[model samples]
Target chain A: MSNGAVILQNISKSYKTVKALTEINVSIAKGELFGFIGPDGAGKTTLFRILTTLLNPDSGTATVEGFDTVKNYKSIRNIAGYMPGRFSLYQDLTVEENLSFFASIYNTTIEENYHLIADIYKHIEPFKHRKAGKLSGGMKQKLALSCALIHKPEVLFLDEPTTGVDAVSRMEFWEMLKKLRSQGITILVSTPYMDEAALCDRVALMQNGHVMTIDTPNAIINAFPVKIYAVRSNRMFHLLNDLQSIPETEAVYRFGDVVHYLSHSKTFDPLSITRHLDSLSHTEITVNQSVPTIEDSFMLYMRKSDKFNISQHDN
Target chain B: MTTERPKVIEVKHLVKKFGNFVANDNLTFDVKQGEIFGFLGANGAGKTTAIKILCGLQSPTSGEIKVAGFDVYRQTNLIKRNIGYMSQKFSLYEDLSVSQNFEFYGGIYGLSRKQIKERTSYFLEKLELTNEANKILKEIPLGWKQKLAFSVAILHHPKIVFLDEPTGGVDPVTRRQFWEMIYEAANEGITIFVTTHYMDEAEYCERVSIMVDGRIEALDTPAMLKQQYGASSMNEVFLRLARAQSAEQ
Candidate 1:
């Protein structure tokens, strides 16, 4: 009701006995790049489906571009483009055919909407005649995005668009999205990769059908409550197990070659941890205090939410 | 440490072609034992074709290749016996119980009944999944299933293991745990040959090779590759190479 590009008020959904969403409230501004980040089975897809008018919420209301998802669904559908988490375009159809088909559905020609998807379409232009099924992973993602944008929708919903894409392709995909946003399209993307959260203007971190936190990636990361240290040793396999044995170590998770040791004590000394690893016969152990990234903040939030939910259930 | 490690795999002038399209063009590389070797490439960069050839899944068009100290051409059966393979997609039967899947794979790998039992218990206990061993694979979470898949892959004590994007779609914490498992395997003298799209993971490997347009465009430690390309990260290094290839095309 506040005239945001998308608004959800106490939206709740359930699939049989499983609650998929619980009192979810989020507001995204016009032309903003919004991200929904969580792991698989975090109800990200369910929320996206409700917003795109593909599915209905069991309670409360949701709107996209000022149109009600349930009542004015047809109107919402007309102005929204959705690329599902999984590939959904016509596999047997050529890339050009798929774009034309989507364009025709909106009562327009591909040439009329070419400008909207020109940047993305040009990548797949060479394979325009190739069957969609034969396209490479990165090429198929481009094709799907092109088809979705062929109708020139005012809002775009991309669910896990870069889930299995390569690092370079992922960067290119995000660049394309940024261009679309600059052209005044409101975008809501969902992804499981926490690193991608940094690319969004705002992100909602969700788990177990609940929204734990929503803010700019920097704000969320800045609000991390604990100290995280990157600790590495010549013996990485044994380093993890030995670090986990520390009485003060809260969490020991590996990040590439180094293990991130989370501690609840702010007065923690790096030398003490290194000394302990050194005693364990580890060589060249290096422990450095590190700033928290999105992943670290997410883990902290997820753990806190779980504890809160458990205590509430007990009461 | 590297000087003491022996070479477990060697490929010389590897060439694989489908009709006129060259999939892998004269690729040559050596993977050392007990090292995590990263095989990186963009999609459709012929990574899959080269991996297929290495696993003896397909006959190379023309190449001198050896895997696990056995010739890939005439001694494929011997080569296959000394390696483990896992892909991004779950390979375990959904309906089968965890123990059942382990047993099935054990039979295929020619493990003795006694050996299978010991290996199954050791792995399940190591992963803290002993209680869930009787549950069907469909009931387990994806992170647990992936860990289980990796455990089953190396149950036969293969000298080399090939992981094809084994951590795709998993959450970051789970991915971290999966890599820890990988490090444990590598510590046991298992040569890990992995293909991944995640750039951060390339940094984890002791050595990495980036394939571009069916050729090994770069090969070195992640630090060396980044330095050579004048880049900040493996992602940047890959972009430089991939963009160059696209410009040529």
Candidate 2:
């Protein structure tokens, strides 16, 4: 059990009629960067709250760094730094004051754990005098992260930390996380962004309170069953409808300028679709076999689960 | 796709300032009718300030701006009436039921009772949420709530809709679905002026403008921006521009 920094076994939680989590089991090894990838209502926040000792599961056992979340709630609180989805820092207080406050609560000084948060803190250090509320989205993210790490906890739990941040800042934040992982801090982060799944060492795709799959991002992507093709035409609006009408096209979704056509048959030829679009008078048609991304795999898994739910309902 | 779509939004030499800080510096752009214009920038790069000015929420320091052919300075009321807006924090009453939220927003836009009832049913069926019409807004999934908020924002059939990071925290599937709705609205000849931090989402826009340090660094279609910057993706293009600005700073 000590092999993993965090462990959950048969964890189930519910609120009245809604099942927040169902038979959930996951493990995060020491110093590993783990990601919970799902939508907003996918029970990510509930699981995070339980693991941080703010909420207890109705059934099953959970542990953080060898301490039971329920039995050793106090110990878990002391050793785990949790940055909730919402900005939890004092709005009226300045950045430096907030850092000092969090450090103080852990019975430590900023200087005592400065090394742990120095990478992230340095970005927001210039605005140390500004109120946390006055900072921009990206700056606030950094300040909140700095406060979370101010206590030098063994594990860091961040809930959608990079939400609403600019692309550049999001890339920088992930870099900072990788650096933190190098320093041997077990990080469990949750985000709704499928692109972010690739940044994690391993990610768990959760939906409707169930874990669909957990593996390295590469493995998850490679396991996509269907062949995907990226199709482009001058008239993108009409191209979508045209591709959907093709019998071979099983799933089609717009990805930026191109429509990703996922065919059910692995041997499906993409040229036939191009010819079909061309026959529809769609000009500048281009079709290429595309590699499946994390989002593609996630959507496939979601569709599979939806079928399962529908069959169960019919029964 | 056509260049003769008639400019829906025109801005020239637009500038906004707070004390000594210039938030929007001499920005010039024209958004064509039925176009999805992506307004992209880093934090504090003047995107929000410029959007507020366009929305007539704040008077610009200096500019010649026309939204839907109404002068921003003199016809602010007219501009407000002809436009819709949704912010990062979804503009919906969480305690209100889905149908009730629709009715309330429709009322604010001066919709008649009959019109509200008709449109409420239309949107609910379109979103496949007729079964959950009476459910409180907070009880629905984030994706559904976002689509509802967007539907309500456009209930008045505004000529233009300004979305401020509409897909900020939603999943990719939902984000894709939301874009489909936007495309449907755009097809109906409604101009979409969206500001987002996601560069990939920027690629969805017909044209995108990158703002840096209170000024536009680049503006073009995503393909052109990538080619101009010698980058593979929009994310790299944004990073190149943003990092260059940071290096200079």
Candidate 3:
């Protein structure tokens, strides 16, 4: 418990027959920018609710800032700032009003913590008189972040902050998170985007109520056990099936314009794949070794865990 | 080969303004038959506005537009019949069962009882959701719901389909599978107009148009755009264009 700013010891929760979380154990260090990377139904929201003291876990215990979530719920609420996935600000309230309202809730004034949200609030300042509901998607996200930081909480939890945001705005939002982290704020953010995993200091790749793996983005990519090759041809539609028919091919899936092919035998020759496709009348074929991305690592981990779960069911 | 295909969607100097704000400004493009066209832009960049006009959901302020050979201004009902739309936010009813939702959408599209029944069974088997037909939609996984929504959108055999961030929060494997489904549909001569925030998905499109501040800044093949921008990936190219817009403001 003393090792990190936030710690969970075998936290598990269930909603009726649905197991939203199972034996989730993670320790986030103080001032670390941690990411929970997963798709919907992965129990990210459930885990966040437990950490923020909004819901009690069915079993096990969790701690934030040396306080038990259940026993010290009030303290956790004071020190932790949470931005839910959905927009929670008052729709009729202007941007300035929302920020000041949030500040008042924490017994602080916006002027007292203006520096904390200055970089982000400035983006929405031009539209300070505009109603929150009238703001654009990107502007709404910034205002939400500003309100969440107006109270100057030590730990910030951003749940799917960039879920529906565009690529440009998503990039800009991440830059704000990086800047906040430099101020020694412990940030715990969750997102379903695999590409954003690379931007975090560390990430937990989760699926089906389980954390598949937790490590630095580079570490996870480097630890991929198999080599991958990018294969493309003029007929990409048929290239997927053709690559899978090869005896050495273990997995084949389309990645952008190319098909990522993994072989059962690592020492397999690349020329053999090209020759096979060539015989199948595929023209302008290019097969080259490619580095595995975080998305690739995530897919591989999900497959492994799925097989493990199936074998357990068999037993 | 692609040039030989007929145009399914054509826009000439399209413009849509809300009071003083211009949501879409002088947009012009053509979507060829069976082509998968990607519409990309930053938030508040007029993509939704342009899409609304193209789908006949809203009247354009001024422009010449044809969707599936139907005029946007005069033949809105005909345009609606020839196009299918699916979005991540609102595609299926939560309380309805899997088959019930299909039946409802099929009915809305004016399919006969027999056609609805046959197509419902066909798609359920294709998605391996035959057993889950009686199960409620909210009970299924998000990935399955997305796939089912896509299948239902095309049940009426519309000539063109518009997808708005269809795979926004889906897992990587499921996302790829959805793209494969898109490919299969396009092979059958369905013109697909898709908008996605994923730059990698942008690379999968036959061609893409990036909008900046209610106007198109770049329109070309992903390969050509990357080469022109001197960037390694579509993500870099987007950042260069979108960032340039913000820097000027």
Q: Which candidate wins on lDDT?
A: 3
Which candidate, 1 or 2, has the higher DockQ?
2
Q: Which CAPRI tier for candidate 2?
A: medium
Please give the C-alpha DockQ score of model 1: 0.44
Task: Give candidate 1 regions above 4 Å deviation.
Answer: A16-19, A232-238, A241-247, A274-287, A305-315, B230-232
**Candidate No. with top DockQ:** 3
**TM-score of B chain for each model?**
0.98, 0.98, 0.98
Model 2 lDDT per residue over A1-315, tens place: 557999999999999988889999999999999999987668999999999999999999999998999999999999999899999999999999999999999999999988888878888899899999999888888898998898889999999888777777788889999999999999999988888999999999988788999999999988888788888888887877788888877788887667899888767877899789889999888888889988888777766767213111110
Candidate 2's DockQ: 0.55
Tens digit per residue, CA lDDT, model 3, A108-155: 998999999999999889999999999989899999999888888889
Q: List the candidate 2 regions with Cα displacement exceeding 4 Å.
A: A307-315, B1-3
- Listed models, DockQ each: 0.44, 0.55, 0.59
**Candidate 3, RMSD to the unseen true structure:** 2.3
Which residue pairs of candidate 3 clash?
A: none
Best-first order by DockQ: 3, 2, 1
Highest TM-score model number? 3
Question: Residue A81 in model 2: shift from native, Å?
Answer: 1.4
Prediction 3 TM-score vs. true: 0.97
